[model samples]
Target chain A: MATCCGGLKLDPAVREDARRRLLSVRGHVDAVLRMLENDRVYCVDVLKQVKAVDGALAKVGNLVLQSHLKQHVVTAHERGDEDQILGELMEILKYR
Target chain B: MATCCGGLKLDPAVREDARRRLLSVRGHVDAVLRMLENDRVYCVDVLKQVKAVDGALAKVGNLVLQSHLKQHVVTAHERGDEDQILGELMEILKYR
Candidate 1:
């Protein structure tokens, strides 16, 4: 448990997986930026690369969600904080 | 076209559309974070919110791709730089 965050920490394996996924996503983002800078690349080809980057990012998001669920949400339930957290989550979702 | 970026500028309408979409995605992300912090919320409910956030982000990604295609890709073709740009894009896609 990480006291500062007041939630359980991610399992070591999950943390490693998340790290790798995040780095992979970063690499994809950088590549996309370089493609945009190069003058000879076709517009359609760039679009395909952008799609790849999007997929990589979505995967990373999944990793984060998985870690959050295992580390924080589970622990919060034992502490009886689920209702307040749910409200906060709902508030965050209400964009308009 | 903007000289600083050396690409065509986004149309005013597309830019406005992108702005709105980005803000919507941001709101979703914020909501997801809050959901994680709350303890009373069920893990399953938080998962649903995360899915909604993912969808919003995907839509925002589409907007970016649309703007980039219309603004940058079309202009690069006029400059006879499609070949180089195409190579760069292909390079970006080769992440593995």
Candidate 2:
């Protein structure tokens, strides 16, 4: 059932890294949520959170994009179905 | 030469609404940025900002998405080049 050669179990270090980064991102989310809940609108504070969230999400997004490009994109390019694959890729890009 | 009948000039209220929403979003980003700059990683505050930013972005995204669906999507569906347009649509979706 494995899609790629890499096993389902990510390396411990990688897992930890992802966890830490995810927690960091979550922390930021929490802060902003608190502000909103209290109705204490701090524009600057919210802006900072957005930036941090963006940065964190970007990192994760790049990782996913890299994998997609390396695997699916490469395969599609070689299989003569680049158009179809490219279309799919474009759709996914829209999500960002 | 206009893409749609609606003029580019959003109604004053709409314009104000967009501006207020955008500014609110920016304000959140600024707050988070300040925290990062000072190395004061307040997880709760940051989290709140992330949520607010996401909400604001989602609202804006929905507006754009509606237009894309109404304009390009409708046109594509009628043109009998569904595959091509679908592909393109998929690709654009990929960005999100």
Candidate 3:
């Protein structure tokens, strides 16, 4: 197992939820590709589908972030890993 | 064919490029799913991968938006579609 900071693992339920959401996002991307391939698709319609995928992906990110906060961030001080946790949080924030 | 606003179609080259990028993003999402499934995955590492997918998806959106601007927005007045074009532009801006 890839030991995370503070030696805490992702909550199992959260991990499963994220995996499921990611798969749905993958399917959403496939739908957008199909729209692009069609000869008569509207630009606005394609944009809407693209936007939907974006929203879905954002949700996935939120799910992971929430899980990380609950499983790792919440317990950082007691684990004596507050500095490492803070650094990791800062790194993830850059992507947001 | 689904006629787009102003009767303009997406440029074929741009459409193909967007499709290719979307496929790559789909694969990227699959990789994230694999990471989530692994017993030892780090939350920060998983988050970084998710962020990479977000960036890639944004690039796909930009490619489509650029093509739309070039093919449709640029020629709207000449085609007497300024009002419709404006509405569509506003709608897309909400997504951004």
Candidate 4:
């Protein structure tokens, strides 16, 4: 969250939003853990909670990726840094 | 998944598994789209399904990151490619 968004010297607002959602997940996960509630950790309800965190993280990932594409990739492309652009594209392909 | 796992020239098995799970998401999201099921897309069941895919993708991401750490980063460090290793580390930090 920080790295992708951070790399761009992006607005702190965007970075903070990602941080907040991620922290929410961490806080919830910690609460769950503190309760020692592993009885049905893999059940639907628990899975839903897990999914909430996952979804949150994925959204953050998408934001970071979008930022990368817009700020880093496009800039590199515009500047004719073909090799770096290719490297970035190749890196993006791996996350497919 | 492919790119992250691919950069290291890992075993095809790992790559295939990531592809499979990703394809499953594609199939499912496509199926849902075909059925025009966005009316209740934000509901619990749908969110649960969304979470499943997110969870799977996160796991795949973890695998790719781990492979990169072991194969690329570790290997580079071993071979004294400190600069590349730092670049990789910095890249990984953004996905936090």
Whole-model lDDT for model 4 versus the true structure? 0.45
On lDDT, who's better, 2 or 3? 3
lDDT per residue for candidate 3 within B14-73, as digits (tens), equals 888888999999998988888888877777788888888989988988888888888888
TM-score of chain B for predicted candidate 4: 0.66
lDDT of 1 by residue, B1-96 (tens): 112233444355544554465455555545544544444443335445555655654564566566666666666678887786566445644642
Tell me, by lDDT, which candidate is best. 3
Q: List model 2 lDDT by residue over A1-96, tens digit each.
A: 112222212233333443455556556555544543333232223333445565674564454355446645677656676786577557556635
In terms of lDDT, the poorest run of 10 residues in model 1 chain A is: A1-10
DockQ of each: 0.09, 0.03, 0.60, 0.03
Q: Residue by residue across A1-96, what tens digits does model 4's lDDT show?
A: 112321334334444554455455445444433322222121122223334456565675565455546655667656676585566456544534
Candidate with top TM-score is 3
Ranking by TM-score: 3, 1, 4, 2
Q: Native contacts retained by model 3, as a fraction?
A: 0.60
Candidate closer to the true structure by TM-score (higher is better), 2 or 4: 4
Candidate 4, B16-84: lDDT as tens digits:
554465455445444423322222121122223334556565665565456546656666756676685
Per DockQ, the best of the predicted structures is 3
lDDT, residue A55, model 2: 68
